[model samples]
Target chain A: MFFIKKNWLTGYITIVVKGAHPELFFQILAKHQIMSWNIIKHDKETACGRIKLADVMKVRQIRRKTRYKLSFGSRKGLPFTMKQLNQKRPLIIGFLVVIIFIFMLSNLIWRVDITGLDAEIEEKVSQQLEEYGVKTGNFQWNVTSPGNIQKQLLADIPELLWVGVKRTGSAYHLEGVEKTIVEKEEPTPPGHLVATKEGVVANLFISKGQPMVQTNDVVYPGDILVSGFLHSSDEEDTNSGTIVGAEGEVFAEVWYKSEVTVPMEQELQLMKGINEKKHYLQFKDIVLPIWNFKQPSFSEYQIESEEKDFYFLKWKLPVTYTKKTIYQTEITKQQMEAEQARKIALAQARRELSRTTPPKTKIIDEKVLHESAENGKVKLTLYYSVLENIATKQPISQGD
Target chain B: MKKNKLKESIMRSITQIFDLPSEVTLKLPRITTIGTIHAYIENHQGLIIFSSEELLLKVHQGHVRIKGKGFVLKMMIAQDILLEGEISGIYYEK
Candidate 1:
């Protein structure tokens, strides 16, 4: 198309000339309708305007038989001049080449795609995406939501600690870190009130086991909550001489301490905007992407994206296109004063001590110890050695 | 004086080309072995219902017609198929 439109105009309508004589010659040609005059200039070296055939440049023309012409005249002055640019070459050719390259390179994918998997117990992380809308030959958001699908899959299977879904063109990638759940040990057989914490009995409640402490008694950590219901000493059976133990509850004093630390810098998102572009490629599969072209952000910001195909065209292509947001954010760092830090530290200590201490454990006293402050950061240490009478009891299944 | 065989042949040829709606009854083979999106209709009929597979149904003035995934009329021969008021037990009548 370009060759057809612009090539002829360059070939016949214009020509380059030099000097007053050649200029007059081109003017004659123009008058005779043999040439349409385009460019006439004075400065022979640097180009001022379009060069016509009359413009002077070192060239040669074949006349009669042997043409030994060499002088600055025009392209006609050159010995054997193939088609060469006059002067507007850079502007015309540069625009054409740049436009062509940009258009062609745009077809290449900048992202990959993966989405659509629905399974109960099975981790169809890859297969489900391939089933609904995840494959090569799709644009961003052409298949599945890369980031959201990754997070959802990870969340659904709590055993998965991490999942990374990325798009590299049409193909969607799914990398995951499966979570490992550790099992806990079972409780000891009941009947004996074993000590869970060592304590001077601050309080006591005996339901099935012996009461080892009284109220106002202090207790150490890991004293028994209650003795084991069955005593190893009482191994013998009934009448034959067996020492049988009774079942009950025992409340003892339990003590606990905790340490807390909060960093001065915290990142949080304040605002965000969304823009999405949809692309469909390949003969079959689709690649969908929701990308964010935005400013850089702090390390603490989290991003989310999603895509769902309503119906498929040709039984394979997605009929519906989805838009998502790739997010970039700046995390605002927070600075905390000494007062807030102290309060936060104390709260942390209380929560930790409360969880480990048995129920009904009272907080006797709490002391706040302010540590050294350095570089806009202050540490608050809470020496909360609490005195509480706690009863630790866990049910254990007896052998039938 | 007219040729009856030629008339039959012409009618059959016309049926094959314009009879795309009939081909809509034939079942589409499973798309993938993994997921449940097993079938898709090649020739689309206006009315479509979905359960396990898809069925193309057509309702006209007096006669009603149903085509499977490809084009089989096994149960449409005997009874009067009432598409409006939910009538069942139909066989290939036409």
Candidate 2:
């Protein structure tokens, strides 16, 4: 289709052949290989048809022998249009210059877009690229090879698993997939297992090394529960033992003692009611707040505040809405029994024990003892027997 | 004329027995029309007459006259002519 249209644009002329036998003329034209189409006969002696501009000259030379009066009907095609355009030379030159300018401009990287990265990571990568002379408005020819840039990015940005750089027209697209890093555990050296607190050894499960203390043996902090060395049996080779890292769990009856005193009469504060005040600030995520007044107006009130930041279209806005609820309170005095004071002291000691115990420790037995109750106050002591891991890895001292 | 008819009948029989196209076996003109809008004439001799309303083309044995409204000779080469228009009637003159 383009070929035909191009030929039409190259110019074709319609010509009328007035002769006795127009069919003979058509036959002759076809024989000469002169492309002519859309032939319409007016009568027996006259017909009109279109011939390409190249063939018009050939037709002029061939018409002398046919005795046919050739008259051009209409001239059309790019040749005539170009002939008219020849009068305006500067306009054509300007058009050509504009086309060349656009072609050249498209070859330069005018924009750089880095996607699929966290804000911190994107900033670091952008700074790295900028340092490497890769930025917007850099010529595509002057840019380093994408493979080299990707390698540099992968090495410099440890969190990036894969990096890709693609140039599309005037834009450079940088994308990466984040790496999931798994931390390697450091090797634990040969060590002894020591007690971290005072306890009676209830049971011992040792996987390595020799047990220095038996079940029901009372031990204190710094006592070696298990030895890291094995005694050498050979008489001549006499080393103390083969040292290894001690590994095991030691369940023990651990005693926790605390002295807590509670007065019989005390003053307690209670919340009577609550009032809330809310404020909202709307801004872009890049903006920061310089001042925030959060002081409560009431003297004997507690203020609890919550902040909620709004996100629009997945973009975090600096806009934060804060809600503060002021809880009003009143103070009153009351009297308590000695038994009640003892119980409160016991609960306080138990809470402190639990807070100090390791997360995996299990309490098997507990006892509360009222040491004294006098002078409108009471004192109590508490004990807890727990099962826990006491295998403290202590690297063997090289000097020994 | 009688001998020519006998030869034509022999060729027609050969075409039927061999299951070959009649255009290849009998040197006949192939005329294809798409409804009343377009037509293609293959193995045509030359143009006899042409106009917007009527077209006459020489074929193997005679001439084909097509009367139509807005007749256009869309394409013309050595032995093929593509015509497009609202065709009213077609006639063959021997």
Candidate 3:
């Protein structure tokens, strides 16, 4: 028989009885307070929980001891790990968190950078960076990778000399130099100047290194006019730069002035009172202007203002205004007065002299070489030359 | 406000490193007569809930020992809590 709960007033009992009297045991269970009844196969000897009800139910040939086992649902007991998770469920939730800690610490710039710069150049690299995209807190808004953004910015712009972009935690860093070309160079340490031709030295002006020839000295080709060889006092034992700086041979043209003449008709632009404003539009090599007539109303010229714009680092366009006084030339039958001819000749000589002269030098003298009449006008030919010392000489250190 | 969030995240990492038991968080209203701190805490995918007056939790030798007063545990009850109070320690048995 099966037992349920702990109350006797409720619950049905399944009774099993032996001794060939199953109906008799059922009758006795019904006489007492019983809820329900169900009888199954049984051979009872020992007393069990349902053995008290077996006296009423009777069956034939009942024997050995049999007992009832009570159970509910299925099995119990689970894995200890599973049980712990069920208890502390919050811990499992915490385990699955994906952290972008790297983004969190991206406030500071990584590498401070400059590119295309020179050490002693007039323009500073650091100044360029401030003007460009390199600055603090500027990295926060970058949608792309910081390094990639820096590279693209530099590649797209030509003003930058070089670029180096990097980052550290909260900081994005930039490092680079501004671009500059080298022009001036170091001294030609110690060297000798050699002769370029086979001739007597008429004049020697030393610009750099040592002059190996003197005035009136006969020199041959491949001979030393100036020394390219140099040395330091401490390097007396040998001519190597290990004890000093480098010195090498270099040769340049040296010359004295000879008479040269060019015939020219002076056209002096004389200005009258009339004046007009002229405007010009020029993009590149092409010139477009409002003025067309080659003959001007006046010739006194003055520049007003000029403006320029550079686009894409390629095209540079300029706009300029020029004001000029206009005048007319009258060619008439007039004899050349001595004073006027002499003045005109002197001015012509001055122009001829200046053409071959250096910018900072002055004409020393002028003399008439020849004179002739051309097209009813007196033309004077003159011999003129300028005197100036343009020789470059860099002496060895006197070491005072 | 951003600085406050950063500080809060830093505190979270610190707590995880040291394995803190439960965080007692509170927001103060303009005026208060009832208890200021909300005792309810969520756990395990919000499948379980916990509310207690005084919670004592310590991790020793990898075993989590949870002790508290006026504890009310709910949903996915894994461990049986021994309670000694007039209040309920577990709200749902199933």
Q: Can you give the TM-score per candidate against the true fold?
A: 0.34, 0.39, 0.25
For candidate 1, what is the DockQ-based docking class?
incorrect
Chain B TM-score for candidate 2: 0.89
Q: Which runs in model 1 stand beyond 4 Å of their true positions?
A: A1-190, A218-251, A271-302, A307-323, A355-362, A387-400, B1-94
Residues A95-123 of candidate 3 have per-residue lDDT tens digits of: 54322233333333444543344553314
- Candidate 2: lDDT of B70? 77
Ranking by lDDT: 2, 1, 3
* Candidate 1: tens digits of C-alpha lDDT, residues B1-94: 2586576566556667778433322321111111222222222212222111123333321122332232211111111111211222222222
Report lDDT per candidate: 0.41, 0.76, 0.40
lDDT, candidate 2, equals: 0.76
* Candidate number achieving the greatest TM-score relative to the actual structure: 2
lDDT for A330 in candidate 3 is 41
Instruction: Report chain A TM-scores, every model.
Output: 0.39, 0.42, 0.28
Off by over 4 Å in 2: A1-12, A19-24, A31-33, A41-46, A73-93, A99-400
Q: Model 3, stretches more than 4 Å misplaced?
A: A1-185, A189-208, A216-224, A230-269, A276-339, A357-366, A374-400, B1-94
Instruction: List DockQ, one per candidate, in order.
Output: 0.00, 0.22, 0.01
Against the true structure, candidate 3 reaches a TM-score of 0.25
lDDT of 2 at B6: 97
Per-residue lDDT of candidate 1, residues A84-114 (tens digit): 4445678778999986665434333333433
